[model samples]
Target: MTIPTPPPGPEPLRETIARHGLDARKALGQHFLLDPGITARIAGLAGDLAGQNVVEVGPGPGGLTRALLDSEAGRVVAVEVDTRAVAIITELASRAGGRLEVIEADAMRLDLTTLCPAPRQVIANLPYNVGTPLLVGWLRQAAAWTRLTLMFQQEVAERICAAPGSAHYGRLGVLAQWTCRCGVLMHIPPGAFSPPPKVHSAVVGLIPHAHQPDAALFRAMEQVTAAAFGQRRKMLRGALKPLGGESLLAEAGIDGSRRAETLDIAEFDRLARLHMRRAAA
Candidate 1:
């Protein structure tokens, strides 16, 4: 089959989708982004892609795929689980003049660090079903990348970039902010995709932290946040009953009477540090 060349004009996106008869698959949580302008905007947020490796997930109809290749990126490795989409991506990859590599596999099951080389960046309009887990996985293995620019439902984006004590703040916010510098670069309305998703979306960028103040303290930080936010409405003492409860707070210099949602990220880190010290001794 002759692979169609990358769209040469502004309307290439819609034309490609129509020509290919590519329909978004609900089973894959697929939402085809058909706006070249939006794709360009997203790629711009990724900063300098020159000679850098980028991994894209769920490249439905290759909207963002074209943009990444158009950028100066050395290579773009697109991972798509859907068999049909994978076939379509194969065509897109061929037309990309060897800059795009389409992988047919489940992104969650893959170890990205091993898949792509150094100077890596992840830029994707992630599938809604798997977006959070993917973000958490990448954030946990943060040493693998220099930066990540991804799209998610607006609510999830807010949670990822939310400040301490904000209503959107929770385990995701704490973990993401602790390991990386996160910011929301753009807000995408529901209408941006071919089949508009019910919720609005946003692009977020995360630059991983190189020097962690308390690297060993993350275990306790995870335990503390899980307990605290697990019962956010309760007083810290009551909510954290499993992990030394009030005693843990007293030792960490945090007030036991405060609710979990009210505590900031600094306080969480302090508690983690205290827990680490106790464990060591």
Candidate 2:
């Protein structure tokens, strides 16, 4: 569990990428964050990693992976879907003095609960294409991880932290905010990446609430959000027609004339609770 001083990898990240022939693959939504200082800052956003097992997704060239190791985390488990990136990080694991483990698999398919023991936090510059889905999946089981410090495309990050009535607010904001205390930690310009992405990116930190929604309630919330925001332009009475419509709104004590975006998280939670109750009956 001892991390070597000066960080591992004999060569610089750019050189390592060159030596390994690891070009940023657009198909995998890869945008490599090779700057150690930036990566270190990202790791720092996770806060007090000591004795915490940290899980990293898409550890391209292991820049952030190295930072996590240096953070003195109890253990760092990196999951990479790209074989090329996996190979790169596998080499990093070798220098980590048994403190790092690399898993070559699609993070979407893996059960995160089984990745490691308790006191876990997920810190990563997530692959853009799969980032939202990954966050949604993790949000469903929000209580499992201690905190999730992740990077996402700027707009997506806005959506996650967006408030009701804001243009960016929607289902993502509802689900994430409902279960966790979320905020934007930092913003990164496109130039920070190996091959800069077209859009700016932002890092978001989410600490799950002590009282998370139960399975049924969560499902109800999902259903409610999908129905409400699916046709966001429509009033609740119309948008929610498929899910008991006006009657559901009436039961939940919500105004049927309201548009989806106007409803706050508590309103949504109430709708979800009523939706669940009706479905059960």
Candidate 3:
């Protein structure tokens, strides 16, 4: 399908920033992505947004927001906590002829499932300070989103897509992989941002599983993973001692002597399932 050209913005991004004195605040973990080519490329990673309702978080200066509008998405909801950005994008929304909706609020407190119509997809350059927490929250309700194309610090991205036995693997990897199919889409240099972050950044894509574990099982998985990885260096027998220790490992068919990092997603799932069953009994 042919993609529509992005509507022209009210003004150049730089001028808009200068006019509004929109400096990137350190407290908010703000790193503005100003390059049109990069923002467009980030938007492209979301893929065929034609009829999709897209939600973007931390849309500073509306750089990525403009690109989403260009994709001809059925609707583009830009949620920004900063009122300055909200004012800037509100102007862009006016020029967008109703395709754009700008909401001023903290993304962390908002429930995305009730925010838009499906098939819903979240595409954003998430703020560094709250990126991981927001991602963990989304993983809990992974089925609500059709896709998640998010930009996070390179290290955090590795943790999300890391495999068992790897140094980066831990609770985040277990929870993320269990809920969705995740992978790093691209690596972006620190220089890509207006005020570059000290470390590099990478984009990650997550598509929820067709058959997700129920709430009880999910909570069980959280408990098991937290306990196991809380002391990753300890053997399962010791790490999971509070949860029945060796007995729990034996019931789940996992070796008591193995470290948490040595166990894969399926093994973790087994442990969580058994833990849930035992709790119910």
Q: Highest TM-score: which candidate? A: 2
For model 3, the run of ten residues with the poorest summed lDDT: 1-10
Q: What tens-digit string does per-residue lDDT give for candidate 1 at 1-281?
A: 55465454434666667666678877777888888899988999999999899999989778898889889999999998877677667877766778888888899999887768989999999999999999988877787898999999999999999986788999989988988999999999989887999999999999999955445676677787888899888999998888777788898788899987787777888877777787788
TM-score of 1: 0.91
Model 1 regions more than 4 Å off: 1-11, 212-217, 276-281
lDDT of 1 at 187: 98
lDDT of 2 by residue, 1-281 (tens): 33224344457998778777889989899999988999999999999998999999999999999889889799999999888778778888888789999998999999877989989999999999999999999998898999999999999999999999999999999999999999999999999998999999999999999999989999999999999999988999999999999999998888899999999999999999999998999
Q: By how many angstroms RMSD does model 2 differ from the true structure?
A: 3.7
Give Cα-based local distance difference scores for all models. Answer: 0.85, 0.92, 0.91
TM-score of every candidate: 0.91, 0.96, 0.95
lDDT of 2 at 90: 80
**What's model 1's lDDT at 25?**
79
> Which residue pairs collide, candidate 1?
none
Candidate 3 TM-score to native? 0.95
